[model samples]
Target: MHLSHPTPLQNIMESKTCSRRGILLPFNSYSSHKKDAQHCIFCDTTFPLRNFKGKAVCPTCSQNILKLFLEREVR
Candidate 1:
């Protein structure tokens, strides 16, 4: 059997296997923009973007503010 040298490929992303569904997705060595990360305006904390869609505040801060408003309304 004979073997040839590997060709030089440019900007090829590595593949990563999903543990749950066993799907193959492209994985990059360096991340420019992570989709999951969202900066909460109220608490100034970083959290998942899924929690608040088109909103600046995080879940915790929003809930706390709601509770305070409800308490005042009941009084």
Candidate 2:
């Protein structure tokens, strides 16, 4: 069985050790338009209050906290 050679782009992608990770926001999104910012209780990042959706913590931290809680419960 003969193996096909990888494309230049595929080789470049495979050679890279690190890649972009975590949440990505658009330049012209609703989060960018918000003028008011608040600190998350968990991460303490200054994100828009609207991101919390009436909660004390931002969505990212809230999700992380939820994951940790669920993991503990499963264990």
Candidate 3:
């Protein structure tokens, strides 16, 4: 007998919010946005994507914020 299961690629393809290259979607080929978020990461703060002077925020803080934001949406 043979059985079938959803492969990792299939699972991703089936997702509605599937993003690629950390961009909007479908265009981003790198798929760098496939990251997980943590709970209680952001206590009380609104994290902006890019800060003033067009410079990005601190890497550590940015990562934490991204995780928190994503986790919240997932729930």
Q: Kindly report the root-mean-square deviation of model 2 from the true structure over all alpha carbons.
A: 11.8
Give the distance in Å from residue 73's predicted Cα in candidate 3 to where it truly belongs. 0.5
Top candidate (TM-score): 1
Which candidate model has the greater TM-score, 1 or 2? 1
Model 3: how far is 6 from its true place, Å?
A: 82
lDDT (tens digit, per residue) of candidate 1 on 1-75: 544743344213221332345668987644545664557755677653235456666667766867756877999
For candidate 3, the C-alpha RMSD (Å) to the true structure equals 17.4
Each model's total of backbone clashes: 0, 0, 1
**Model 3 C-alpha lDDT per residue in residues 1-75, reported as the tens digit of each score:** 554987788787778565544645446443454343222224423343335235445445566766766888999
lDDT for predicted candidate 3 compared with the true structure: 0.52
Better of 2 and 3 by lDDT: 2
Per-residue accuracy of model 2 over 5-50 as CA lDDT, tens digit each: 9888888888685685688765776567557555776667765432
Tell me the lDDT of candidate 2: 0.67
Model 1: runs farther than 4 Å from truth? 1-21, 27-30, 34-37, 49-53, 67-75
